[model samples]
Target chain A: MPKPAPHIDILPDVPLRLNRCHEACGPGADAFAFTLAARLNGPVMWISESWTPAQLNPVGYSQYADPAQLLMARTKDQTDTLAVAEEALRAHAVRLVVTELTQPISLLAGRRLQLAAETGQTTALCLIPQGMGSNAADTRWRCTPVFHQADSTQARWEIIKNKAGTLSAWDVRWDEKTRHMLVVPPAGNRPGLADASG
Target chain B: MRPVDGPFALTLHEANTDRIYCLNDPAEGQGLSQGMGLADARAFCPDLQSRPADPAADARFLRILARWAKRYCPWVGLDGRDGLALDITGAAHLYGGEAALLEDLHARLTRAGLQVRSGLADTKGAAWAIAHYARGVAPPGQTRNHIAKLPVPALRLPEDTVTALQRLGLRTVDDILTLPRATLTRRFGTDLLMRLDQALGDQPEEVSPLPDPPSFAAQMSLPEPIGLAADVMAGTERLLAQVCTRLTQQEAGARALLLTLRRVDQASQQVELRLARPLRDAARILPLFERGVSAVDAGFGIDQLRLEATQVERLPARQLSPLHAAHQDKLHDLITRIGSRIGLDNVHRYLPADSHIPERSYTTAVAAYSDPSGAWVTLRPRPIRLFPPEPIAATGHRPPRHFRWRRMSLSTARITGPERIAPEWWLQDDSWRSGLRDYWQVDTRQGRRLWMYHTPQTPGWYVQGEFA
Candidate 1:
């Protein structure tokens, strides 16, 4: 008799949110990603062409359940850059990988990264805004800023993504003076991702 | 120590890159403003002193302030150009409530001859806003209301952002408060919202609490900077002794070290060393530094010497074996003696590579600090010497039995295997440009066994390694 394969909870295939970097996303995209990484607790990676210390200047790694590791390629356009990033992800047991690239990813590279993420049950958030072509992406997100009509001191972050079920589009109001993010009006009562109806 | 109310403060100012500009007046008649022209300032006050800014001096002063600030609160950070931020949350009660805390701080700073403005709030963002905007200083309870009256600059928005807001006909905090939140984000970006959020205490902003002094660092401040190699060695010896004592006290050993030399001319020279194993004795550490210091070309005198143990491990407290004890002592002695003479970094140990690539099987890491030999416990069947990629004149798919290596023509006596090794498809390594390689162990006529490989895709053979 053949040995039975171990029952595993494979990660479900989720749509990839694609956007052209620097266009749909601004300079603050890196900061936003970093903040999310902190909130997520563990398993986040930031991949980019040109990296400055400012991008990685969050709370130190010792604070996390797993130490935060930053990996880089000597050159951006080099084909081996993705490989290096993959190695880092495997080595560090990263849960999420964020990339900032000037060019769009190839279909093969996207498939490879997706497979790795599925195998590891990791989430990869690729920031590609307008202008760059899609590479077999699972989903696409368009992030834009919006201010509140009642109070100018607050602003709203509108996240429009294709794969977010009924919650594909949502807005969260943020106070400019307090640096606080608040849900506006009726939507404010719902929890994060609560509106997503699969 | 002087009373907290009356600590002496010294202010040093510099003009451009040269000249010293200092004002000893504690009564606010220094005749200088940030944007005032140099010529005009001089004309405004004839006795005004001017000197070029010495950033090194400013850094040194900050370090001093850091040490002194510990007397009040352990958490202190240098806040921009000429300010320090202290998190006096829990520590304030020691001096009494907020009022007494400020009084104590004021007294100490005044005595130190430093001008200070302090603001207390629930958040660092709020505190920062209050400190820069409110009159005198935002009293603790009314921090938010007080900040509202201050100019938009108090929000700490970038100059361009502030200018854009002004152009939008939004003059005050009240004016912006009436506008819609979505409108602000669409026009200004999230940063505007973030700043506003910070002011209203909606988000938490943490001050990186100053860390307690570590036991692994050794520092020496010279009366005058020393430029010669021997002078540097003398300072290094003192620092090593201190660090060794610290390591011994903690029952820990250092495996990696950084030797920092700050030049009198404001330049810095650094040397790093890694060891095969952790070591605590100064005798072992001093020698490695001798070669290291000589390598540092001190363009100017070195004013400070800082030695830091970058990596450390717990030292096992076990009795030394009679046989290995002497050997261990001798090995350590030799390492230290050689370090003193040739410098520490020149010595190295082999560390196992994390990759499967033959050329990457081992790498050179700093001796004395890394477990290089320990990384590879079981030895694989590897050649004693591996040559860098060498070109051969072979044209066929099969590796030629006779090939030239380093101007010598050698014929193969015995050949073993075409071990097919494929390049990682996902990765593009330049060395892998030859694509699939078929490695072979060939015994040559010169009694020299060689490791040769033929790239089937590229159709060529190359000598990769030699056997002992």
Candidate 2:
């Protein structure tokens, strides 16, 4: 088995699927994405659809990753978006290739992307909306915004599925001073809810 | 040459008419004038040989000759179909003098089996007149003296104007020049006066030379016509190599290249390639022409191939680390391939803008031209993506507990307080007319995260963006 990379502690050396629990959890996923991309060695390629209203703002993203090392492609459709991501992975230049799809991808497409990532020794992340169909991804993570305190940057991430069959969760807070995500322990030893029951 | 030779005086038949468009010097010597009826010409020179006139071939040959004349002077103009005008202003001293330049030009062309006549004068009009009417170089400042003896037709006036002047017994330029300027203008109109003044150097006439077509172009004429794709590719590779060499020497790269194939059947085909980034490497540029080259019909067979860089740009010096440089090159190559497949307009990159407003904080620019710069001010949380503010049906002055958005009735699970973002009053934005906004991060029961803001002035709540 391939060991997980030092900085990328969430999954092994394989492509990961990030499923957004809500429409508003996009920022949290992007925050984790940039953190993961920053640890990689080479440049990054971000592919998205042209109709996507919210794009990766370089100004905001640059805070986490080197903006100069980032390349973007706005594809016309979902197929082109996935193709671009796959091509970027196979190019062996980008350390990470991120793509967002309006609809869920097929198992074949997911396997193809995974194969390309393994061949190029690169990481791939597919950002999809909630309740999408399953694919052959190594790990599936669902990120949701945790609204505990006002003006707090906290997110709850649940590893719903993993290739190793291990399930875990974390209440992650973005530490502005350290510029790294800190895993917050459960409060008062109370049993932590698997889902946001607010 | 065959058309001009034979046992008869040769004349060319006009394409659309039965009249004689032009006649060889031998036929002209036999009293066969141009624009004469074919029957009349046949009668005048009982053994008159006639062939159809090809104006396209004539124009093409003239253009080629004009290009060849560039060896003498940078500025060469095609004077009519059979004549060439060269502005050898400062280039006269290179070949001894003005007289020697004309002699060399005439002698070289005559040796090339061409009946060449050249004239040198201060003005283009006088030079043209001397070239056709008199076959020698005219002394500088003696244009008036030299052209005075030439006929009125030598002034390049309209045929009707020349005939009208001839009717008035003004058969020569001297006759018109001797006449009073007012009478000449009144009788023959301002055209006659303008032509007379232009020839006599009284009025400045700008001889606008034809635009030198392509700055970087290489051409090869094969001994035999090549119909095979491999032969055409070989020819193209040679041209590309030559052009790329020149580009490298000049420290420039071509942004667009044009390949013209002249077939033996007189039909020409062109293939054009537009590049995303300027490039000079022939090895890299050759494969790009495969699609374009194969698309060329190559009707009959191509006898001539010309490669030209229609658009060029100065290549910036690369100053990156070795590792990063290789990655950058690969990225650039990938972008170029994708851009060539789709289009450069489809590739975009975001650049930070100097604005505090959420929507105005960034701008989109073509990826080829922009590089990421500056730091993102993340003093407060900003959504990964922002949309046009959609009004939400909510009933509350404070943050609403439940709202209807996108046809979904959802209850707010938790609400973060209104982060008041005041409008920038200095700038007039139509969307911000509501003055002040109090934003809240709303988490709904349906696991949907939304960034909604309450416009105090407009007294309404709207969904501005969504968290990832």
Candidate 3:
């Protein structure tokens, strides 16, 4: 068994173990990672594959975090993207690093990134379209756009596994005016959500 | 000692006539002069043996001789097609003096079977004229007096200009110098005076020397074959140290280093490392080589190693780089380490561009080459991921309509008002050719907020972005 590393937090409830890698897979995974990046201080690095046919819109990213603090590394291959993300984390040049992968990486590659992130004290997030089934990551997140009831605009982030053992799930909304993620109370009548288009 | 038993001449066809381009000393003595017709030269010397001239071979030979003359001085230029120009200003003292230097050059070339003429002067024009006409070293500051008696052709003017001056009896530099300066310019243009001024040291004539290109490479062979990765890395480190020392001596930094390994079976393997910036530090370079060193397979015990700085740039010492130097170094190191895996060009940042269109609001600039500038100010609601528009199948233009996207069909639970975006009339965009768009931020029942647009001109709906 590999050694356990301390978890780090980008937001309040999302305490992702540091030196270890966590992942958010399936639909809306990148958006969940971007929400965490908004809370991180210092520089951030993002890695994506070149032929993915999708573009990152900085206009929406600016609403979450300062795009100026973000550095992007686009690789030709999926393996190279993860490898570059590992090196970026190992360099400890940034506080957080995000990687956009077409598919989930293997447990060995994930563990390699975990060790590298631990060495540099960087939190790495691998956002893939498919879930990481039975991987060695610290946690596996599934954050999707959900409303409390009708006409509500909030996101539901559910943690399928947490090595650090935090909350099971949390509901939050991106507050545009304050530029922070406001956690909605789970116990009661919900705060009526504003129009998501704003 | 001659290839021909008698006088020899090399003639070339020029201006529709076979003219004598060059001749040996014996041919000159037999009145078979340069530019003379072959028949006329044969009449002058019945035993004349001649062949065609090769100007291209002569020019190549001249360049070779110029390179050889670099032993006298680092600055050497080709004077026309036949002469050599040596700028032995400070270099002459090494061979005793200017006259001694000329004598040594002339003696060494003469021993090589060349009838070489030597000259020593302060300027290229004076030296070339002396080598052709005077054939000896002339005293400094006495160029005007020395070349005053030489023919006007020694000034290196066009043949027509020289002939025109000769027809007017301005046969020597002294004749032209003695005339009114304005009258000379009026008669022969500035070229004649420019040459005379260059000879008399009134105008500076720079000798653009042929530079010997510098090579940054090092190679070493092992005493015995060792197939271990440690042994290969050890060899690589040693080679890198040697190359770095040489690079330090030249004040240069390597942007890319190529390390090649040779095995006992005569197979070669290469590991290349590219950097985001020029680097020369051996300690900093050793770790970078570590990443690529393991990838090379040491087939059948490697026996030789070579490291070469394939791309290099100048990196001078900085005096006031003390502040934030450590911070900048770590960032650069990170960029380089990541850049090596993904290409250096792939590492970049998105800088905000002033545009009303959602897609054109930001431009990705390679991080190493640019500075972080411009604050991203989002004017309206935009999605996090904005790919090219994928057509959506809908019944009506209003909200609550069902559409299939990415293998999923979902109905809109909530819809916002259509925010109209018109095409910039001055710009040409093929995507916006369908005309003005009425965008609707729709929250689907399937827990997805999609940015949908209706092209008013075509009256079709399409999904473009995700607000998730």
Candidate 4:
């Protein structure tokens, strides 16, 4: 019998296979991707080139995990930005790597990241604002803000692209008190939402 | 200037009274001595010419002269407040003989408008005593016999201690040496015995030399002002050459350098540059200053330029590499490669600071130089993306029902807090000038969870951060 592939539970019964490259995009994508980092072990390499007025506060990140576990690299231009990400993943020194790119990824660049991840057995999660383009990524998740009752406001997480052809959507809320993900059952996710395509 | 042969003295004010600090030979001839009250000196000699003494300027001038004395010997140290001590053990042959060296030093300093008196001996204390009491070179190994004839004060005792010795009918160093060692120590304390022993060559004394080349600074004073950028670059390069040469002799390198330019208008500007590694190569260090030097505003015109290495570290010579990257330090290589494009300070790590203020809670440290510390202190819920507080239009101490931020109208959907956090009274913070704040975590109807605070003292509301 063949052994099952290694994976991590992003939510209850929601298993995302590891050792591959994936993309998280849209409004609340940072929180969505940080949830994955909170569950993984070992040091994390995070690369970005954005200069927004506000920065990612480590205090706010304590609700998920210790921000000290992150190795942040602020690279120069687009080329150096992606080059660091590719090199870090290829090193396999870290278990998981995260990158926030300003522009959308092309199929060629996405394939290169995927091969590097496979060679080092590391998970590469790219946090992009643009929607999924023509890329050879294993999965593409889009998160959008939705108005709910109270503190645990539900953010809609829809797996718009799955290479395995498994498509689904769910309302995810983080229970801050327990440090756990509270996913409401799949609801009717509008098709026109992913149609915008960045 | 007063005539060289006139009666003159320098006075210093102390204990609410002015006293004579130094006196010329002519003033001494008139019975005016050091430590005599200025008023008493005037009563004793009506022709005395006196001026206020400046000890700070005199000390600075001595330090400069110490650097110049390095030409006679490699080890030159400042002795007391008004003397320079040079150890010329193996260097006397350069001037033919011991007496020849002293004659040359006295002649050179006399030509430079200075009163020079020197004594060469085997011991520092003996040499000091010989110079002030009897000026000449003591024959080698005859330090004990030579200084035995000097007075008790020549042993460098305190004024009261010397007076006590004189009251005992002891006027010469031989008088104090003839008494039993135990009896002398009991009568005058340990200081008198130690000075006696040091001058007799029985105890060794160390003369720590001054820092080599007067503390790693190179300066150029132009005859006329130069306003062009090229001229400033040339001056900076020349200073770098001198500073790097001194750094090599010390087996160290500069980590931070300050290049200061003084304009003819009396205004000055500085260009500060810090490096990731201890660097001595002028070629590598010069280009780093090019960016800051280009922005120099040479106001009316710059007349003087000085380059000082503010921070230096020991850096032994390493084998030159063709790419400067063949070394096996991976962490250093990573920082250098990224630090070249973005500055080295840009690569940083965030560490937790013990403070209740939102901005002061976490401190940023450059990752290349510092290590990240332990856990983040999270007692209450905090936002992930925080910035300076953005004001919102609202009233009362309650969360705003509707508000606008960055052109988006946000309506409060759910509120979870009124966590009251007052300003640290001990700290003067401009942001918390309104006193205390009631912070609220509001999940807006538009899918944004904002960390907003309301100030009761000022009756205002502001949004500080987002949970996303």
Candidate 5:
């Protein structure tokens, strides 16, 4: 019998890419990235292009990850931004390396980044625009924001591709009280909706 | 022979007249001296080959020579436009003795294609006189006798004073020393007596050494120039080891280090590394210089490598648990690597500022120099991202039912509050020019949430941030 495939987790020493479904889905992906980084052991290195205007606000970012633990680098172009991310990944001191690119990265470049992350045992997250070409990542995800009730912090995530080729989707919301991401169940399984006035 | 193997002189033109500034040995043998009128000099040797003198180039060469003199002594001062004085008082012992030291210096400089003359004396006046007129060492107690026979010009006095003294039949220092002190003072206006006393060691004179150059540096000069990156890395490692050892002995750490590579072609390239914290471990500091070493273009080859700790700080002692210490080390290493790649100024940490205005509530500070302290005041809800209050096309002082921001039209479905934040009057902030602001959290129909405020001072509404 053939050996079972190795289970893959979004663990340390793995490179994971989270591609947004659309431009409006960036905030949701960023929230997931921060939540993932919060579980790591070291600081997070965030590299962005100089032309990118979105900046991480400490006040809101402090809820998921310590703002002091976020080290940011703004590069002049996508090439430098990716290079900085690779270098940060190679450094074992950083637990996570997050890079945002306006353009798609080549397969070879993605492989190099994956190798660096694996060697250093660092978790790498690449945030790219929707419809970008394929990359050599252990897991590729597409995150989108879900419209919920007023004042609800809900986000939807779809595992577009995985190492085992398994695809799945989940609706999640950031629980402010617990400071954790809670997976929202299907409507039928939810408490109030399952049984009415029983 | 007139054109091929003849006398040559360098002429300088000043005040509409040409003068002989320098001449070859053959011209000197023909009695053509420096400062002689060109017409007269040509009369002496009609076959003279004369070229214009370049004083600027000569001064530049002199300055270069002064820099080279630093190899022998830490304190090398320019004696004049054509001379360098090295204070080798304590440093002479390293070369066996004062006489051997002078001989070595003279031989090395002469081999470098310079006409060298050296003198050792107890005073600056005596040294200047002996170096120019006598060209030998003047023993400490015998400085007076050594300079007695030298001409009055050796005293470094004005040419008019020398001429006036010569007319009085006092050509040598001995003649002036033998004269009555009061008479010498009255006749020469104390200048002659002062020079006499200074040369005899009766009066003290201080030699102002060149302002101390940067310290806390180690350098290695390779015998054979190497062009390989490995060689540069090895050289850097050796230099860093030496410098870090010294830093440890001094109980200090370096915050900034500069590594300089002197190429074989006399070009120097430098790589600067700034650390987020003061560090002295050579093992940790060596890797920070690896990328910089590879980036250097060792055209021809590199002959010397120098590492200088330009900025230093006192590292305070801290007690840490093993786990905590390891984590701190990891953080420091990460910060240092990122700082080296993207400059330390780009890396910053946010500190809570003591203010109520949303924009003024936090300040960005350089991570290397600041520590995050103080509690964050979270009395009111703040947006995850705060931007310059962008004016929204809203209707009135109350929350807008419909508005356009960043080319997106949104209809408000629910509103939370009017949190009033008063401006700090003492601080002059351009953004806070409007006195009072009433902030409201609004959920829009397009699945968007924004923090909009109405300013009573300006009577307008603006959207400042978005909640994620």
Candidate 6:
């Protein structure tokens, strides 16, 4: 049997997931990592196929300097970069780590991220292949593009995978304009549709 | 055959230039009859290599020589195509005498494989004339008599002017000097008298001493270019320290800083850091530059590092407020920190401008640099958040009860205005041709509310903002 991955203690009473995800996974994984970084107010490791150190910390974040917290990388590689990224994820004070190119991860990483988010704890977003699934996750999500309500703008969000939840999975919408997720009405309230207005 | 003693004229005419101006030739073909054209000159002497003229390269070489000559005198200006005029009044004594300095200049040029003629006089024109005309090296104080004997061409006048003088039977400068000054001025124009006056040092001619352009910048050229971010940070720190020292000496602080990285290939990468307030402290500056340098794309390697402070204001030693020294310092520190992170321009404080127009009354400028409180003015009540005026479709115009904004409808519950805001006739803006605006506060069914106004002059209504 393989030895359990050695874990570094980031915060008390927190479990860190250190695993690598495949590079084929695009920005859906990256968006999750960034969202967690903003929420955690500390460093998170993110491993992806094409990423520059510059893209991680944009000039805009300079306004919110060190006291506000910063994202940092401990170690990186093709297979284990995601694992190290997970190390950044599971802390109360520090929330998430995103790793790329390890054992195929699907619902396991998603569930862990969702669990952390449910408790208002820091979440880790793992970018793995489509088929990788584990029974350990609280929720598993697949991100896909959707049309914006007002204009021809296209936006994408995770396709929710939940083991225990009352919210309908298909009706969830993430508004890019307002940077918020809104529950789309089962029958959307379209005044324009009622009036037949262009 | 005896060689011409003392001095004789040598013109580097195109055809004979190569043969006569040959490097390391003991007898440099001077005085030997080689006529005007290259074919004729080559016929006179075989084995002549005709190199194409490179004027640009020749000019650059001359400038390099000029830089080296700064050791003799600080004030040096290039005279015409092939001449250097040095103001050696006080410097002559340092080189023992004018004769020794002239000898030294000749030897230096000779060692550099260049043939040169040098002269010293009270005036530049006289010295120039003596060097090209009378003697290869003129003695001090003898330029007046030496130049007087030379032809009018040696005065450095145009070819046309020389021809005109020759037409007037005035071939030599002595002939012009002997003519009445009024006659020379009237017949040949003021150019003749001007050149004569310049030679005798009657008129004051100014040499634009290259104004050491306000050295607002300090830089260092590295022995070898460096690519690492750490190296750039180190260079930035050094430059900041130097700049801070300069700022301190001037009792000033920099509000804006420009850090320039000159790469090995002569390409430039610049990072600009703007501060909320002018500060001279090195601690505040170094970290800002540390953040700035990290973003600089060090393509290949950076060979030169330069730091310039563009906007400067006096940084008076903070006079500790007896009431709250700590608070003021802390506020100043916070402004510096926040300004460093975001751009200084992004962080602003509102101050009142002298105008009646609601929008024009207040202006935003970098917070710490500008006064926060504005003067009290009696005018129309201003909205907390003035959004871009969105056009609204309404009926029965005094003030509509409800209007749609961003696809949401809001109904007016209260009307508080007919606030008359007039546009300043002195200042003209097409948009504010709106003579007056009557503002109203409105509420909506969806727990949303907004502030809308009616333009009385144009007779139209606009939704200005929401009560967030």
Which predicted model would earn the best TM-score? 3
As for DockQ, the candidate ahead, 2 or 6, is 2
Provide per-model DockQ scores. 0.01, 0.28, 0.61, 0.33, 0.28, 0.02
Candidate topping lDDT: 4
**What is the DockQ score, from 0 to 1, of model 3?**
0.61
Give each model a TM-score: 0.35, 0.61, 0.71, 0.65, 0.64, 0.43
Q: What is the C-alpha lDDT of each candidate?
A: 0.58, 0.75, 0.81, 0.82, 0.77, 0.57
Over B1-468, each residue of candidate 6 has an lDDT whose tens digit, in order, gives 244432222324464343332222322353234234554455654554444455566777767766678889988777765677788768888988888888888898899767787767778878778777765545666556777788998777878888988998888888988888988778778887887888767865544333333456889999988999998888888888888888887788898889889999999999888775688878766765665678778888999998899888888776556875443444455445444543344334445567656567555555566654545453433333355678898745466766676776655544555666666777778877777676765544443345677886677888765432
Pairs of colliding residues, candidate 2: A24-B467, A25-B467, A25-B468, A26-B467, A26-B468, A27-B467, A27-B468, A54-B385
lDDT order, best first, reads 4, 3, 5, 2, 1, 6
- Model 5: per-residue lDDT, tens digit, B1-468? 254468998899988899998787899999989899999998998999888989898887877887887777777778877788777777878888878888888899888867787888888888999998888788668888899899999998988889999999998999988888888778889787777778787888776766644367999999999999888988888899999888887778999999999999999999999998899999988988887888999999999999999998876546667766766776677677777777777667788778777767778787778877766656666677677778986657689888888898878877878998888889878778887999998877675667899987878998888776
Query: In model 6, which runs have C-alpha deviations exceeding 4 angstroms?
Result: A1-140, A144-168, A171-198, B1-54, B136-140, B211-285, B288-468
Docking class of 4: acceptable
The sequence of per-residue lDDT tens digits that candidate 2 reaches over residues B1-468 is 543573243346556447877666778788777778888777777878877677788899888888888888888878787788899999989999998888888888888878787788888889888988997878888888999999989999998998888988988889987888898778778988887777778888775677754358999999999988888999999999999988887789998899999999888999888776788989978877776788789878999999999989998655657656666666766676556545666777667777778888877778776666765566666766578889987756676877788887878878777788888888989999988888887877665678899988879889987764
**What TM-score between 0 and 1 does chain B of candidate 4 receive?**
0.57
Q: Each model: TM-score of chain B?
A: 0.45, 0.53, 0.61, 0.57, 0.57, 0.51
Candidate 6 lands at a TM-score of 0.43
- The deviation in Å at residue A58 for candidate 6 is 18
Higher-scoring candidate on lDDT, 2 or 5 = 5
Off by over 4 Å in 5: A1-25, A193-198, B1-214, B316-321
Writing each residue's lDDT as its tens digit, candidate 2 over A12-66 gives 3323432211111243677667766665635777777877776566655656666
